[model samples]
Target: MTVFAMLGSTQAMYEWAEKNQTVFYTQILSRLMPAPQRDDPDVQVNQVNISHLTNLEAATRIAFALRLGMQAKQELEERREDLL
Candidate 1:
């Protein structure tokens, strides 16, 4: 139960971090691009691209978290088994 709670908390923190990172990236991109009308197809495509990039960035971060979590869990189990 504690492990599950820890996992949930870790994921929640990761989500918050991901959201902040996306906001930072979006701000940077917005500064680089000129403002355009909402009806403009080019502007819409750029917005979609930004969304895709943000998702990709978040996925990369989550993947790293999962890998680290798995590695830590494995090491803990190994140590426990050794102690027993």
Candidate 2:
């Protein structure tokens, strides 16, 4: 996420995430791997805003973004009672 580096603190990070839900959603969309045989094999999805990172770094960035996204949702969702 472009917002990853922008996070100044734990509180600020979640606040920024809450404000920019669409940005994270867009990041998730962009990071989705294309068809295996897509013509543009070299097409980089998550590296546009984030530059000068190695391949491993780019992958790590994506992973962190995904983790934060899921964490945000898990924090917001209401728990349900068990049927059993």
Candidate 3:
């Protein structure tokens, strides 16, 4: 929902989602929802293979990855300023 809003239009949202739908579930799911522990059986349930993803889900994953990159960039800029 939030990512769709950032995309600026229904068409853009549709295009981005369509482009990303083929990505494997593990690519995003593991980052979004990690098991409580290593080797946990619940991880299997989260690992279900799927051919397509909901538009909202795909948007959310892209939004999350973008946010992470933005944060890293901001931190680097701040560190550089401190050294100046």
Candidate 4:
């Protein structure tokens, strides 16, 4: 429960942080979730490989946000194992 809460809160924070920003999670997730399309011929591959969100501070914050969610998941899994 606690783990879920932390993950939920962190995820919510990320969403909230992006509410006013042009770059949202969907933009990044789309690139990562379906895997890179470097091999595919459909999408136009850019010569310069760079992410939209190129700010260092923003990048670190995003990393921390994801790390928190992962920690939460680990905590929940541990709890589940204990319950069983």
Candidate 5:
């Protein structure tokens, strides 16, 4: 049950991420840029590069986190059933 809940939450998070990828990347770039006007040509160029790199990093991190969580949940279920 707990495992299912975790899986559901993970799925939901992934879905949300997928649905808002553009927004998420935009926000990330916005944060990376200096304050005030982020529309400067130089800032825009840097933001574009940073956004691409950060997007890849974010994807990798999410995948790694999900894999770890799934493994931990599976282990917990196995232990629970063994004690049952």
Candidate 6:
């Protein structure tokens, strides 16, 4: 049987999607903005320009970047605690 046939109807697929959907909002994405200039010294400035990307693409990239940053921060903190 076809995938749709197994699922019974398109309505069922739609229902499943709606039920499992996790919406991403601009507000949430804004909170994950790139680091401010304060975090990096003027000598080695880096920048993130998301003006060309769509909302979803920008949000996904920010989320991944934040996750990596958080992981690295946690590891450093843990190592510092261990050394103390």
Q: List the candidates' TM-scores in order.
A: 0.36, 0.33, 0.40, 0.36, 0.36, 0.39
Question: What C-alpha lDDT does candidate 6 achieve relative to the native structure?
Answer: 0.75
Question: Which lDDT tens digits does candidate 6 get at residues 1-84?
Answer: 598788868688567656655532344345657856565455775587878999999999889989999999999999999999
What tens digits encode model 3's per-residue C-alpha lDDT throughout 15-38?
Answer: 665778655344654566866855
Question: What C-alpha lDDT does candidate 2 achieve relative to the native structure?
Answer: 0.71
**lDDT per residue as tens, model 4, 1-84:** 687587777677577657845444556545557765467577775453336546886678678879999999999999999999
Off by over 4 Å in 4: 1-54
Q: Model 5: per-residue lDDT, tens digit, 9-76?
A: 76875677688988866875578778785465655342224355677787886788799999999999
lDDT of 2 by residue, 1-84 (tens): 557556665677677668888985687445765746656778867536657888898899889999999988776663422322
Cα lDDT of model 1 by residue, 30-77, tens digit: 776887856755553322243556777978867887999999999999
TM-score attained by model 5: 0.36
Which is the better candidate, 4 or 5, if ranked by lDDT?
5
* lDDT, residue 28, candidate 3: 53
Evaluate all candidate structures by whole-model CA lDDT and list the values in order.
0.74, 0.71, 0.73, 0.71, 0.75, 0.75
Candidate 5 or 3, higher lDDT: 5
Q: What TM-score does prediction 3 earn?
A: 0.40
Two-way TM-score contest, 3 vs 6, winner: 3
Measure candidate 1: CA RMSD.
22.1
lDDT of 3: 0.73
The C-alpha stretches of model 3 lying farther than 4 A from their native spots are 1-50
